[model samples]
Target: MTEANLTYVNGEPTLRFERRLRHPPAKVWRAVTDPAELKHWFPAAVETELRPGAPMRFVFPEEAVVDGAWDGEVLEVDEPKVFMFRWHQDVLRIEVIPDGDGCTLVFSQTIGGGRAGFLAAGRTAAGWDSCLDQLAARLDGTTVPARTDWVTPMAHYIEKFGLGDGTVTATTDGYELRFARDLVWRKPADTWPVLTRSLETGHVTKEEPPRVLEYEWSQGGTVRWEFVSDPKLGERVELTHTLPATLAELRPLALATWHHRLELFFAAATGGVDESWSEDRVAELVKHYA
Candidate 1:
């Protein structure tokens, strides 16, 4: 196993990284600071000491083979397990601990302040992330292809900036809401009417069987949509804000909505929601009923 985990905390724009090395402190230490070894995983450059209060210069020779270098200070350094530093306006923490048959290494950074702050933090974080992955591969005696020419999608990268608690909740005018249960619906002929009505009434704005469905809702001006899918069934539909108020008021409100919607939706195809209904099966019955 490669000795590292990298995570970008969404809300508070901070980088949290960790790695478990299969080697001892001595070997891990050398891999981190030895100029030759560091170059294997990091940018082509040179280094001085991993010590406290010392000015260490690591030049990305490749940058100078163009024209620049990043300079920083070594804030704290302890043999084998911990190293802390400040690099170009960011706080960097590195931790190495002895674990079972090897060592664990961790790197963390917190950077945020201004326009330059975002750019600097992002670049620094991604650069370190790629470099650390290289470090892990090297320690495990593996080879990694260098991605020097790669360009990251900025939108996708920027999306990582939002660190909202994964919980979805919204409140307005005494209505507090959250997602209850989400399901993907498939085209079961037994449920044709519901599907037909759903599509006809604009209840569904998008469709890709088993992929996604978007349902819209509006209550006294507040509006949002629930996304759903049933990948296994190859037909998935999402329920949006079309449920009656009585059902919407329930705790985990979405659950009640699903129960009510699914029942009505399938009733059109299966004569009832309790029985299994396939598209062909329902279609045959639907034609007879028609």
Candidate 2:
């Protein structure tokens, strides 16, 4: 299995994967194009005619399901050469080319999660990696891996694709941020401990169990945290900070500092090492979010 390459097609991020199969082009074509063969390795139960303008429905097995999916029209089919289709908001393309006596399977997908989806490139890539591995196993007549290790490949993709950085927006009232960190693996019953531990002191303005927590900041304004449910993790955090007019000039600093603090808190919760903070690191992040 080759490492995925991130490319852009019409300003959309595309994850491309290449696999060299020992089988010939005609043999590989059946595995990729035939529905019966695809059932062994393909992500979902693909149902559609082998022609363009045909309806496509990606039915997932209930127990091993992931997220929003299961419908599209077949885009193209060049018979034993190219197979392309739409899977929800994504455009997936599969190409089979002869290489010596064997063949090459080229798979690429155009991601479609909006801003959040852009940040989830690694997750998407890791998933396809697992699928391709299964395809290889089936072709080789070997037992497919029952469980794919997502964490190891995801970490590589995040760093390689620069998906760990969060985004900051300047609103009329103040600043809003959406983090791109992979904080989905571990979700605590009560996230308040992580919050209180991160910020230390703040008057509680709103509290709603393990879901929402609003705060009246000691420095002024409001800081709210929301724990959204995630499939892999119990929940993921979303933060909104409203700064007082007086703190307008300090918005960047506050956000940058919180970025570091949040990292510390996440590390603590996940039993990861507490790395020492650096002004240089904060300054660099502020430049991006400023």
Candidate 3:
């Protein structure tokens, strides 16, 4: 997938995606603006004429995670070159540039402000990522499945932006640690204080003994722990950490730190020492995740 970069346009957060397609500008333009061609790849069913100030309605597929329709106006329409539109409150602009026998597509969206804007950044980025993937497939004359699984990609974008749902699992290690839940209810009474003290650095957000425990970190984000009885592992634990949207640069460090902490937590919970929990080990794990 093509990586999307985050930037600010006019004081609003923006996501920019670029792609070099093997198709010509006219063909790419038709694929983007022609409703008939759009249905094969575009997420929503658009209804409107391609002209400036034209009203448009986007009807989402029934299976979409975000259901319902949104109304907007065509902000600009420089045929075969630029197509800009407003969807809800966000502005989407697509610019196509001719390059030899191919063309380059530059897509950008202006995100809103506040927490909602941060959250939308990931969702919108992932959604467009999938749509563009489909578009590429369409241009290549290959079949690409419709987007049905958004959670995985959304999680990716969330982590990419330094905010996470906060669960890290090492399938090879047969262990997972999550910060949002508690290990106290299922573990031995002797381990309760250790677990509680380890989590004391963060403010408790929710607690429901042996089931759910949530806390907000002093630096940023929230952690939630959940316990479930797996048939294979008996009582299992899962942790989720949610970080704020503004800390994109800290994602790598945050992931490494969390991995180290979880290793410590695992050792403490099991009453066994993890000698492998070292700077080198953490670096290796971080590189593996990266």
Candidate 4:
């Protein structure tokens, strides 16, 4: 399988991957369509007839990977050639083309025009890539060990997709931060759970929908978070922590903590490994601010 490709279609995002299977298209089609074979590789358990316009339901096998079910409709079915369906918020299309003795399978998912999903394309594509790897192993009558590390590949996709570009700068007032934060699949309206997951729920000074929020920090000063949608980067978070100029001497400590918090929030949001906080890590980052 090749690296997943990313592209935008009329302001929507799409992720595509291609795999060269040594098996015939018929065999591959079964792996994609048959419930038994699908259980080996598909991310969710599929429940639907193989026909266009049929309602489709997908229930995840593992609640840890994902909980609950998603509903969609089968869009098209061309025997041994094509299978297309609406997958919740995205459209999933799979195509198998005849290639000498084997087959070339093209799988693509078109993301809906939403801010949350597209922003985490890296994580989503990496997840699908892992599933495709399993599909290849299943077709070959072999098994693949489950991947334990999602952060490394996700970082690659994040950079490749030009995301997670958040920065912190010291200012006359205090500190300013601009970083890409994953809202998971939610807008800022449902961000309280994420915000209070690691940090305490300070007094909410201001609360706004889909855009702005502010709160009084327990550590003194005020914290504000803003959501901005960019045409290229999709959606991002901008934070401002207001402090007095007398606190300038502690810029390194404050900025380092906030900087690491950015990545920590991102990892948790994207379902990746979270590094434990340490003084050494903060000290290393402090050099940048100094």
Best by lDDT: 4
Model 1 stretches with alpha carbons more than 4 Å out = 1-13, 64-70, 112-115, 120-122, 152-155, 163-290
- The clash number for model 2 is 0
Q: How many clashes does each candidate structure show, in the order listed?
A: 22, 0, 9, 1
Per-residue lDDT for 178-251 in model 4, tens only? 44555444445545455555665489988776577788766667778777654323455666777666666766
Model 4 RMSD to the real structure?
Answer: 6.9
lDDT of 1 by residue, 1-290 (tens): 33222355555446676777788878888887667887888665645566687775656544333223445678887876677776555567778888888987877876644333443333444566678878889888997887653124221233254211012234443333332221123244333335544642335455444334444443322223333323221232333343444443433433333334443443333233433434554344334323
- Return the top candidate by TM-score: 2
Q: Write the per-residue lDDT of candidate 3 for residues 122-204, one digit (tens) a residue.
A: 56788788889889999999977776655556546655764433444444423233432222223434444545666655778
Residue 274's lDDT within candidate 1 is: 38
Candidate 3 residue runs with Cα over 4 Å from true position: 63-70, 145-152, 165-290
Per-model TM-score versus the true fold: 0.47, 0.74, 0.58, 0.67
Flag regions of model 2 displaced more than 4 Å.
63-70, 171-174, 180-201, 216-222, 227-237, 243-290
How far residue 169's Cα lies from its native spot in candidate 1, in Å, is: 23
lDDT of 2 by residue, 217-242 (tens): 67777777776765522345666677
Candidate 3: deviation at residue 42, Å? 1.1
Task: Judging by lDDT, tell me the better candidate of 2 and 3.
Answer: 2
